[model samples]
Target: MGSSRWIRPEIYPLFAATGVAVGICIAQLVRNITGNPEVRVTKENRAAGILENFDEGRKYRENPVRKFVRGRAPEIMPSINDFFSKPDL
Candidate 1:
């Protein structure tokens, strides 16, 4: 009687957590190099941008929940019909 499981059940969670940790580490490293918000906010040059980001986040967070949502997303919107139709512009 032999078991065919390549990965032991006891180690699965450990491996999964390790993988997640590694991925997060890699993501943070990339974000750091790419000037992510957290890293850039630490710099004096980014004061305005940091404030803008916070203001935007706050505005979004403070917005009241909508009873109903409308429209396709902007990119997907403005259909072929829109080409024939002129705006106020």
Candidate 2:
């Protein structure tokens, strides 16, 4: 019991790693079954050429907040930038 207790702590990291690996494998398996299949350029697809007005090719519009920030420069401190940007007279 004493030796087993000592061994358990050392083996805990291995157990955790194995559990994580197993979980990832299970997740991938489930995703493969439920998710869309990978797109491949087959001979038939090549002959078909580019799809016109593809359903998935619709233009993506940003949300209001995202659009507002899109053109603006990222600043951690706008006040600091404003102060530094002014010409020293």
Candidate 3:
């Protein structure tokens, strides 16, 4: 009786929040799959806008060990400028 009345309001908001989260996740998944924003800069001549913010996380990993071990090594992820700086090609 009283419990049922209390549950309805709570459950509706929970369901609505879940639906919003799922919608956002699906939208991001589709965006990544379509390469609309290109999360990684695979080639030099491809595009530059994708990697502009890639180094924004540098401040948090000032230590050498933290920088290299956090799974974003330079070899594995050369900076955006490196793509055009290398003379060897």
TM-score on alpha carbons, each prediction = 0.33, 0.36, 0.32
**lDDT for predicted candidate 2 compared with the true structure:** 0.65
Inter-residue clash pairs, candidate 3: none
For candidate 3, the per-residue lDDT at 43 reads 64
- All candidates' lDDT scores? 0.61, 0.65, 0.63
Compare candidates 1 and 3 on lDDT and give the better one: 3
Candidate 1 residue 16 Cα shift, in angstroms, is 0.9
* Poorly placed runs, candidate 2 (over 4 Å): 1-7, 38-89
Q: Which stretches of candidate 1 lie over 4 Å from their true place?
A: 1-6, 36-89
| True-structure lDDT of candidate 1 | 0.61
For candidate 1, lDDT tens digit of each residue in 1-89? 35646667898899999999999999768856564444553456556453547764554444333323344444445676677776757
Predicted model with the maximum lDDT = 2
Q: Which ten residues in a row have the lowest lDDT in candidate 1?
A: 63-72
Model 3 over residues 1-89: C-alpha lDDT tens digits?
Answer: 76886777659989999999999999767756554444454665365553554354353235456655776544755776687777873
RMSD of each: 12.8, 8.8, 18.2
- As a whole number from 0 to 100, the lDDT of residue 46 in candidate 3 is 64
Q: By lDDT, is 1 or 2 better?
A: 2
